[model samples]
Target: MNVSDIKWEYIFNIELAIENFGYVLSGIGYTLLISAVGFALGLIWGFILSLMRISQLTLLNKFAAIYISFMRGTPTLVLLFLLYFGFPFIGVYFDAVPAAILGFTLSSAAYIAEIIRSALNAINHGQWEAGMSLGLPRQKVLWRIIVPQALRIAVPPLSNVILDLVKSSSLAAMITVPDIFQNAKIVGGRENDYMTMYIMVALIYWGICSGYEVLQRKLEKQFGSY
Candidate 1:
């Protein structure tokens, strides 16, 4: 095979490739689903963990500290293996897609918790005092004023992480989620167009990540005045 003169048609056929494009889209759909679930779950879980870290109660604070430390210290790949394979030893068998989502969510929550905690700490203590002077309850003050500003500060980093999650979701192929890369691999193998198929997949990832970068910049600009 002359590498330079390799004539390639769209795999199976151009019509077949088009049909499989729909399958590839399905894979991307599942990828988006996993990211969405992980992001939302992480947001809620991380918010609670942030509060626990800042709590005055010794036990609550200590538990949160350990949780954050452990998660931060461990690799996400190891965490995913534990959730998918190790948990089954204890009679907890999560399906592959769910396992991937849960693993990503746990990792995301740990990072987001720290982000929230640091953002909260960054505000001047006088702000809390000012809120109290205005007769706002502590929770009300946090919800209305402190959290809003903290989220503004956190958005840039969080958006970067979310974009990372989207790319990281390629790992879902390991658990058989049929994600974009996996579909590309399958098609590339059948048609022996590995380079072309994977190149297309890479372009897809780059396009999505670029969109996220644009969104992140817009967010930072919008929040700069706050």
Candidate 2:
């Protein structure tokens, strides 16, 4: 803990980071692949959940409400652990990558559902009425008119959720997934330079998150112009 014993050089050893760059960069593909699949799956399932939440059927509405509540209340790490470790009791087994993707998708769906629902609710009822007056079926009106507008409103928040998922994907390391964090840990252990390697990992994550933020802003501007 002494200042001299801290190995301050390790923190700024850009050359060390560069040397291990390929090792860390190699994990980016897995990270991006998982995030994309997870977010896409979550979006599809979440849309259904949102529809259920807003349905006329009491049973559907109740089911969606309970699901959203439970998922939102649970932590992502616990969900990951449950999927990776707890499934064996039911005779189900998932490899690290599948478990991580499934865990992220399930957790993300709850939040995305709520986001879509709120955006849908915010649309003026007049739009729905107008579509109905145009001789459109309810489903047609929902899909053609309501959903398009709701999605525009939902994009910013959805971007935030996606960004969070990207960062949280780092937790895959805990399950022995060879993600960015896991690679960093391996390199750090081998070099005995934990501080520098982890800093590099943090910067990589920061860069990715910042890129998402930029995209979100551009999307917001485009959507706002409509």
- Candidate 1 overall Cα lDDT vs. reference? 0.84
TM-score of 2: 0.93
Candidate 1 vs. true structure, TM-score? 0.86
Indicate which candidate wins on lDDT: 2
Per-residue alpha-carbon lDDT of candidate 2 for residues 1-226, written as tens digits (9 for 90 to 100):
7888986786768889999999898999878877889999999999999999999999999999999999999998898889889988899999999999999999999999999999999999999999999999999999999998998999989998999999999988888899899999999999889998989999999998899899999988887887
What's the lDDT for candidate 2? 0.92
Error of 1 at 89 (Å): 2.0
Regions more than 4 Å wrong, model 2: 1-7
What local lDDT does model 1 show for residue 203? Answer: 72
